[model samples]
Target: MKKTLIAAFICSLSATPALAKTEIQFWHAMGGALGEKVEDVVAGFNASQNEYQVNASYRGNYNDTMTAAIAAFRSNQQPAIVQVYEVGTATMMAAEGAIYPTYQLMEEFSKGFDQSDYLSSVTGYYADQNGNMLSMPFNSSTPVLYYNKGAFAKAGLPDRGPATWAEMEEFGQKLLDAGYACGFTTAWQSWIHLENLSARHNVPFASKENGFGGTDAELQFNGPVQVAHIEKMGEWQKAGIFSYSGRTNEGSAKFYSEECGMYTESSAGYAGINANAQFEFGVSSLPYWDNAIETPQNTIIGGATLWTLRGHDDDAYRTVAAFYDYLSDPVVQADWHQFTGYLPITYSAIKLSEEQGFYEQNPGTDTSIKQMTSVEPTENSTGLRLGNFPQIRGIIDESLESVWNGTASAQEALDRAVSRGNEQLRRFERANR
Candidate 1:
């Protein structure tokens, strides 16, 4: 009877199932090599714990991923986490109950979470009016100048990037004289030329502190500084010294192919540029117009942040909080900063990278960080909060293209862009309100 009872107990134990882990879905927009890195990071996080499993999915590019999230939210199938680009900040902020603010998420589930640990320049972009962070900053980057060192040497120019717009023009001429078909090219035309340009010059891209004060702000980028820069770029386009690539990152190919001697693009482009460029390249701070301001203000960031969405259970949110904690580790962040060209979002990650001598070994890797923290960000330079900014960017792109192709003057194009963009802002205001 004892043997039979023991056998029955063993059978019952064998029939019982082990506790299943909570699965969390994270949707992101990082593609190509960056996509692989995201998977690796997610894998590391998964390996670190057994209570939850995180499945990272590359939905598409930034806009597509954000659209998917919104659609999913409407259908009651949103993921726990979604990566939304900086341009989508205003849209996400106006989503009301659609998102769970990162600040609140951390406060509720994380222990000893300190918001001050993150870089202010980065977190400031995604923060609410009260200074609470709305989304978790990730893959933040600022624009910088990338020069072909080999091409510079061949052109008999200095081994450094141009410091000012005038100097850049001179360098472009020299590069052209040296037989380069294109002297310089830029990616994200509106972003690099108008948005960052206004911020660096301490000019308002829009009224009411660039929309941070209220949603009723209007576009103001047609000011003197912005007009002059675009006019100069138009002249360069006419002279064949500047190549007008598409509105997005299509200009990167012009640089990678060594047809252009200088390129202005996001610091996050380091990985791809490093992989493709056969010749040596150097990174420098984004060039400014000496006449714009005596000293340039800090530039704004252009990258995506992780926003925790609604429609998930508390257990899933707890898992997300745990994953965020893992992501905040200095070692993990440092690795990300080194491998990718994105800024280390936290001060500890910066220190850890410094200790590891990453900045020393990889020259110019800290250029973006330096440019972003070069000065105390003013009301105009902190960041933009304009609604429908992505569509507004499309307007700016069309306007700039008209100038580049010689169909419109700088002032006219910009004036038109401002007028059209304001309409977008008004529509967004009415809808969101």
Candidate 2:
């Protein structure tokens, strides 16, 4: 009887298993094809380790997801990680005691986290004045020009897109003469036409280091460079060379439909363009004003970063850090960049892609990289960090619409936008302070 009891106890002890991995919740706003890419990353991380499992929940668009996160945080149900758009940087930074700085989190949990591995242009946008990263740059992107090779051929223009604004206008005239309905169009009008325009020209878009310096930063986009560019775009509109197609990416439809010969949009527009456009297309550096400065400066980034939220236990935070380490892998970063058309966040990833000849096999894929990394980012070219940026973008959009509609001149519209946007900035400053 004693031997049988001992044998039963040994069998029960052998049947007992180890503790399950801690599951960490991650909330993001990626959807459609991009959402698929997010899932791919999560799957890779989950499979790479048995210590932690990351559960990604698709919240909605950037604004919607942010709202949900705020609500969740208020309710004490916040996830361990959340993806916030570039425009929301100020809001996240202002929410004291709400988020754990990713730099600190990594330091506590990941011995492998090295700031040097990250791309400077990417990290600059998400870093403090002292250059410490506040978040993990996941999907950084810059604007680029996309041209329809078929349309260019039909128009008897060079296969490559224009390098200067004058060349872009010339190509537009030829494209229009070739029976194309429009020569050029753009998505994210404010981002490409104004914010990035100022950066590329090494001009200030806002006071106080593009708003990173202090809450007192005010709009300065009403300057001569911005006015001249807007006026030129207006002239293009009057000549039927450029068409205003709504506020967002609605203009992209005009290009993919063959109505427009060229388009300026985010480098991340790759997947949609690849899947939707039937004609041959090529990507190139965004056109600059040849007379604006000697050469164009570095373009700023547009995309979201992963912020580690507070309220999570140490084990969960460690899991979040481990997941970030997995994400920082060169192979993983390269794959994400290739799949989504976003810039690789790490230098090692870019090098890995180059070694693999991904750029050679896929021409124009390196345009964003060259444009972003060719010049060391100056204070003016780093990025915008203004409060109420989404609202400010809306103000710029309305102002540009007035220009496109011929209701107001570029200078008049921009001056008005600056006036109105400054009011919002002051409001934000007061609230945050």
Candidate 3:
């Protein structure tokens, strides 16, 4: 009955006749304010022209959302478009019968589709072996440093966040001396510290092409550098220079609310900071080790994309592709980037933004794009593609938690995590094979 009500509501909403608008179901995980942004974009598209009517429904977060879609697909009721995180690339690819390639969808439906317009590193992570994109990159963002200007003032340090990890430690110590509650706190521990941290340092997160080219790779987190960094962070925790707020983004609220001095969060945090921060603040690229003179090769993107699933009728699939094309239009993409902190996905949109003086007016908004697209990008920092990555992230989080709680040393934590995570790798490999 609920499904019937939803279908009837969509049909009634679709009755307007400026042009014959085909209804396409879009299932996504964005909710609350972010979900409203998703709805607003769809409504704008519906109002722009009548060729397509996209009925978007709210699914949950990445893991719950993907699970729901896969179940619905088995029941022959999946939405045409599903928002999936980058980590799920390999799992979706291995499901050979389940998805339609974004590359083909663009060619068949959109009048002109150019892959060259997208940042190579961004699309490459979500593409097939032949460089054909599998999903429309949406909300792509990289990690950045978020610090409280007031806290820095109190600590008698420069208002700007540190550029290197050693400097950050020195700054943290001063904040501690000033009796600050915690010098720094971070969100998404594994993502910011272990995965992207390794990439920025040009350290391997795993062998076997970071678990992309093949899945026979074993985990390799027992390196001295990783241990040393983790150990230092652990020691800082004891000295009240660091705090473990939570395993999730709840840590973001702490830093923004002035409960902590520094935070490492997504570049997309710009919108939240703009809305909520009462103290002076600044954004900086993730700090690197001093020896990594060429550190921060690149920060990997952390967001979901629109994935076209199979089993939808041909016209429905075409409609999905058409909607994606509309979203990618230079004007629409630019508008979305301006309103939200998400990086513009297409080169044309970036240029359009620059021409409009968007970045010139808003300082630090371009820091993420500049940091990510600065270099040609080495293999170490290009991106990662591991199957069952959600589970692997959980494993890493557990290990990091162990370090924070003093239940184990940093080296021991990583060794055990590698052992457990490699077991997961083996499972994914066998299942895919």
**lDDT of candidates 1 onward, in order:** 0.94, 0.93, 0.84
Q: Give a tens-digit lDDT track for model 1, residues 6-108.
A: 9999988877546568899999999989999999999999999889889999999998999999999999999999999999999999997998999999999
Which segments of candidate 2 are over 4 A away from where they belong?
Answer: 1-18
Q: Show where candidate 1 strays beyond 4 Å.
A: 1-17
175-216 per-residue lDDT for model 3 (tens digits):
878877788898888888887888788778888657667768
Question: Can you write out model 2's per-residue Cα lDDT over 135-207, one digit (the tens) per residue?
Answer: 9998888999999999999999988999999999999999999999999999999989998999999999998
Better of 1 and 3 by lDDT: 1
For candidate 1, the lDDT comes to 0.94
**For this target, which candidate reaches the highest lDDT against the unseen true structure?**
1
Please give each candidate's TM-score. 0.96, 0.96, 0.93
The collision pairs in model 1 are: none
Candidate 3, pairs of clashing residues: none
**How many residue pairs clash (N, CA or C atoms closer than 3 angstroms) in each of the candidate models, in the order given?**
0, 0, 0
